[model samples]
Target: MGRKRTIKRDTVLDAAEQVVMRDGAARLTLDAVACEAGISKASVLYDYKTKQALIKAVVERRLAAHATCEQEVAASFSGDPDAAIRTRIEVASHLLTEEDRAVALGLLASLAQDADLREPIARTYGERIAQVTGHSRSPRGALLAFLAIEGLMSLEWLGLHDWAPEERARIIAEIGWLVDQVPAPVSAPASVLSSSPERSTR
Candidate 1:
């Protein structure tokens, strides 16, 4: 019974995504979703009480999936201090798809009208920034790389820029090179270390 309910909920969400993609976010009525899913309006309401609730659910679902992907990628680079930023770069550059961008456009439309809908995004970005900078060899470099990647992704997502595959690859390669150039922290000289007040006192 639990499994059936889960499947039905996913079906509803899928139909809702399609409605947003095919029509505009403005056209995403519960009736439209039900019609698209071939389910009853009551069934849609049972899952999502309002349009705002439904949009939030859709955004949350996507964000959850992205978080899972980040975890998996971070795990693969387990011991690396730069794992968080690197994982973000890998996903933004390679993993995301055109359909994902389209869905993002739909969600952005909804988000622009509702400040409440921005909460999840704000929280996710906050967590991601903390992760990316917390143990970085060079936090500034990591942040710069992160910002650049986000800019690239935003341009693509908003249809502001259409980069050729090769061009995009070249840009990502440059970002990677920049990350690699962030020098490791230099250890203090032996004489300087020996002169430290704490060490000398000890």
Candidate 2:
């Protein structure tokens, strides 16, 4: 007897992403994914019971990959007190790609229509906000930088703006400068010398 062909869950997810990227999320269906994967619909169903489940898997997988990239960026800034905000800026500037933006837009389209699927994304953002604000020496400045970075990314993801490379670099450099302007904590002054002989040095 011939052995049955097996397909990995990631294969299905990759097919699903291609469908969303090519046809938009509205057209993503089990049969569409199966066709894209070159597998039987039953095979796709074996892994993901519903379209929502498949999309959620895609969203979670992408989030996990991004988290890994963030950790790597954070590691590069070891011993830096402002690593959280710095890493976020670096990731926004370099790590994000055109494909990432497309996937994000696709996911956003899917999540916007389904509140249930949006839960994980909302939780992830909340956690990221807390991390950026908590680890910074200047919480307000960190929050502002974070918001600005998010806005920049949002513009690209939504196809609202296509900044030239130089323009984007200048914007990011300005944001970095803003972050640098956050004042460091003031150090306590040295104690004054006492007039008494017991306290005075020879």
Candidate 3:
């Protein structure tokens, strides 16, 4: 009934991600993560009552990591939402480091296998999309921008950025133009996730 300690939660989650990425979620075992994390198996069980609980923690952890960056980008453009958005897009584009690509792959792979991940994953994106609203840019435009950004993440994660750099650049560049067509911007970005500065690069 009491709160689980933060260290235990993190240790278990860390172990879960390692297991999921290396062995796949279907084969995840509490003992495996516990051993990998150098903690007693009971420790993991203590934080996560069940295998499902452990998986959720892992998924949430990964989601938060990505969310942290987006929040950062959002924080950069405090007053101008369009400029903030442009900055957000630019920062996201810049964040595609090799390590990020790897982490993204793991997080994505886990999400695909765990249905529980669907809502949080969708919510993480939906919240971001919600930032841009109204008729100036139909739901479709916002959707397109979201998808384009996702695609860019995918390509960059796969080390295929050069495969379509120009195409990607143009699409991202067009985000600014689209922002102009839209009405007032979203509120001041609360964090740097809105204005991430080139985390991923060639």
Candidate 4:
């Protein structure tokens, strides 16, 4: 008889995450994951057929967790289209756990190795931008705000610089102010609205 499936997939994925976090993504192997999970190699294979498959699963799981957090934040705004952008800023400014940061680093390593791994992240960003523009009365202002926030985050993620806590707080506050600065669409002047082309006579 075939061996029964006993280990949960989340358990295996969590083990894989830890392995990636500790040893680096390049060093992750079935044996390493099996040791981390305290499961048989066959059990690991049962859940994940190959290392590439496991890496994909890790990306999916991380993305899913992120989506859940974004959804929760959006829900707090009660259907506001701008909620996602606000939520992103909130999340970025909040203190990140070592585990969260490790997972991000792991994902980056995976992305470096496989460009395809970035598609899900790209798609999520695209969706969030669409939502930001859709809700803002001024699409350009919203886009600018979004780009500015992304730039700050990229700096942190790339280890380019670190700001003091007070500096970060000030920056977040300023970004929030910028996001709220989206103005309502302008209308034509009264004269323009009332004017009509004079009848052309030969």
Candidate 5:
């Protein structure tokens, strides 16, 4: 028979996130987390089969969190596409704030060298872009908007960015305004109909 546990898997992942975020991915080890969590190595293994499994799980958790954030942004839109774009900017700005990006940065560092990780990351950003661009003009415009947002975010996450605090504030403000500037498609009826059938007939 196998031993059963009570603690949530996120607890383990959250602990793992703290370790990776604070220390860096190089120090992420099963033994270290078990020690940090006050659990045995076997217990951690029960939750995650391997290091990659753990890291992948961390990514899964982030995706799930982002999904929740997406839903929240959708709610802000209330079926209004223009408002939805603004909400998207708000979500992006919110995600870029202090400590919020830590998990993202840590996970990025963990998979920075893997080609296999590209698909999941791309898909994740793709989903976000689709949400925002469902209201955009041409398909190309939406795609470009998605790319721009992702590039800025990637720069911030990689610590490869060198913007001052005020610069970051400016960027956020500029992006918010830029996304809002994209005009929504104007929908109209296909046929030009007669103004008054009875009047015309008479």
Candidate 6:
């Protein structure tokens, strides 16, 4: 008997991603994936029972990559409360490329058809929101920085704005400044302090 060839799961996922990028998610089919992967339909199906399962796998892969990026960035600023959220903005500002923007577009298209496909992504965002808000005393400032980063990414993704590298860097730097703008500490009124219960006892 001949030995059976084993196809790597990543290979299948890569093929599927390419399919989505090229033809949109609606065009993703087992036969198309197999053709893209240069494998038999049965081979692809062996790995993913249905199209939905394969798409979910793709989403999961992206989520794993995102988590790793967050961890790596967070590690750089160990013990710094603001580092957790700030580093995420820093990393995205530096690392997001044109190819990543295209992949994001494809993911959005897929999500439009399968709203349920977003559960994992939603969970990730929820956790990230908590981490960001909890890590910074100035939660509103941190959130503003986060939103600014998202706006820049959207501009890039949409191809509506052509920002020079220097301009983009400057904008991101300004956002970091905004994030660090903690409110001035307020002192208790002198009258209230004099009338304190502890002071009354004295």
- Top candidate on lDDT is 2
TM-score quality measure for candidate 2: 0.83
List model 3 lDDT by residue over 1-202, tens digit each.
9965655577677677777767767667888888889988878877777777777776677778766776677677656544334545766566465544554565565567667767777886676666654322355455455566667667777666554667666777876455544335566565665456663343
TM-score of each candidate structure, all chains considered together: 0.83, 0.83, 0.68, 0.81, 0.72, 0.82
- The per-residue C-alpha lDDT of model 4 at residue 54 equals 91
For residue 28, give model 5's deviation from the true position in Å.
Answer: 1.3
Give the poorly placed runs of model 4, Cα more than 4 Å off: 1-4, 79-81, 182-202
Query: How would you encode candidate 5's per-residue C-alpha lDDT over 98-150 as one tens digit per residue?
Result: 45467666666568776565557678767666766676544445455556666
Per-residue lDDT tens digits for candidate 6, residues 1-202, read 8667689999899999898878878888999999999999988988799998998899899889878887888888888888866887777677467666666677776777776788888888788778878888688788778777878877777666867888888888888877877656679999999999988966
Query: Per-prediction count of colliding residue pairs?
Result: 0, 0, 20, 0, 0, 0
In order, the Cα lDDT scores of the candidates are 0.84, 0.86, 0.65, 0.80, 0.68, 0.82
Clashing pairs in 5: none
Worst-scoring 10-residue span by lDDT in model 1: 1-10
Query: In candidate 1, residue 112 scores what lDDT?
Result: 91
Error of 5 at 119 (Å): 3.7
Superposition error at 107 for model 5 (Å): 3.5
Superposed model 2: Cα runs more than 4 Å off: 1-5, 181-202
The better-scoring model by TM-score among 3 and 5 is 5
Q: What are the runs in model 1 whose C-alpha is more than 4 Å off?
A: 1-7, 180-202
Deviation from native of the Cα of residue 15 in model 1, angstroms = 0.4
